[model samples]
Target: MDTTYTGDVTPGGAPDVRELPHLRITKLAVDPQMSNNCYLLTCRSTGESVLVDAADDAAALLRLCDAALEGVVTTHQHWDHHRGLAEVVAATGATTYAGAPDADAISEQTGIAVDVRLQHGDRIVVGDQSLEVLAIAGHTPGSVALLYADPDGHAHLFTGDSLFPGGVGNTFGDEQAFATLVHEVETKVFDRLPDDTWFYPGHGNDGRLGDERPHLAEWRERGW
Candidate 1:
């Protein structure tokens, strides 16, 4: 199924999985129409893959799973990010997971109940890889991020919409929400995680913790 990513490619446009050798980080850029980033993390040892954010184009996402899909984790319940949730869940029958607080909210929106309600510090296993859940509420009350470290100690973070490259996600004009997001990003993402950690956002280009480190104060002072 060519799960391995090829060349020096940047993620955008048509969906394709970019496989990383150090750790099998499959960046599945799904739903070109929406340009949503759906990631598939595959364990080379067991071939079991976990799909992050089944955003759009269910058929394309299902094809990327290639029948080895173990589960689907919805980063947040935002409509744009979960358009294909019900379809993918119905087809694959893979257990759907979401933050505990947002489970019912997401289910109400998508019509598919969350099988697992993840909380901060919970662990989700994809074959040999273990993803640690970090609830970074801001963009949505239940917005979350998943952190996984490969054998080489490199960490990968799947940040739904809380943390981004230039600044924190939009707060819809709510100052408190923006503050919550920045605090969470500082404490959980920036303060705890290392510089080299690669983060895949909900949309657009991916970024490293190091890339956004210098601008933390600026983001906070400006307040998204």
Candidate 2:
């Protein structure tokens, strides 16, 4: 295809469009402050795309997306994650999608109501691609993860803040929240997804499920 961009997006400025030849995914990040990751997955055949987590720097996000943008998906309602939500949506008029409970919460901050209220098992359409919604609540009341399966049987998970490389995300010292997050990661993620499943977290670098699979018990026992 003679694509111009390659490799993973960086966490400094507006990333030069990253094209994943393996899965035909186009992603970019804008880390002006919080280093929140914003991704754009485009259907190579259709030119349509979906933006995930419009965190910070709306202008950079818009530049990466522009007319190809189809919709914006919110993984949770955390303030840092949706800092640029209002500006991005207002500028693009892209439909907003979020978990039912979190949809309203995000709307409160962005002031732009969610257009689609997602639930577990729901399918989010992006051109010819479909991303399955996994409701992994715990990091927040309605935090969810998105799973995209490639043609070759591998999978990519967009785990907002639920599942990270070393742990299951911060519970803010709440034991119950910690337990819930742990339980969901075990059942909904580690148990179901394959070892090769690559996950893109909210804040840092990408991680493979296999690299993190062995630490399930440790994470549970530590309870952080």
Candidate 3:
């Protein structure tokens, strides 16, 4: 299995694929305007897969699957995150999952009902593997991060827009929102996971927990 993927991608370009012992992760950038990152996680053993954030470009996303897709998980209710959700779900008949608080908004936006409303500590099974849901509110009332604890190695986190390389997601200058996002990220993520944990964000590149650990205080102080 290859673990050297850089997670770099561009809209309308090919996806960056990473092969783990039990899972295969493909990161694709969609929506030129939003530059949203969509991830497909496949269980090697069972051939079952789950797509995180349909984002946009239904044709491209469907091609990425290449076969059956078990489910789609939207991290938040942001419009850019689910632009292609309805189309993808219609074609693949995949179950839709999203954080409870944002489920209604996502359903309203996409015209597709969320099959499962996830909460913190919930487990989403994809074939033989499962992802733990870590609800990190602030970016949105229901923003969630999916954590896959690789039995063979360290954990992999699909953080959506709640956490990123430099700092937490945009809180729109709301001090309360910023505080909530940063606090949850530190407590639920940094304090709980090891430094080696690799994180995949909703947009742009991926990062390691260890690489961003030292700057947590700085991020908080800056109040972004």
Q: Which candidate ranks first by lDDT, i.e. highest?
A: 3
Alpha-carbon TM-score of each model against the true structure: 0.91, 0.92, 0.98
Candidate 2 residue spans exceeding 4 A from truth: 1-10, 14-23
C-alpha lDDT values of all predictions: 0.82, 0.83, 0.95
Tens-digit lDDT track for model 3 on 126-154? 89999999999999999999999999998
Score candidate 1 by TM-score against the native.
0.91
**All candidates in order of TM-score, best leading:** 3, 2, 1
**Residue 183, candidate 3: C-alpha displacement in angstroms:** 0.6
- Looking at model 3, report the run of 10 residues with the lowest lDDT sum: 62-71
Give the Cα error of residue 163 in candidate 1, in Å: 1.1
How many backbone collisions does model 3 have? 0
Residue 124, candidate 3: how far off, in angstroms? Answer: 0.7
Model 1 residue 144 CA deviation (Å) reads 0.9
* Deviation from native of the Cα of residue 10 in model 2, angstroms: 4.3
Candidate 1, residue 12: lDDT: 45
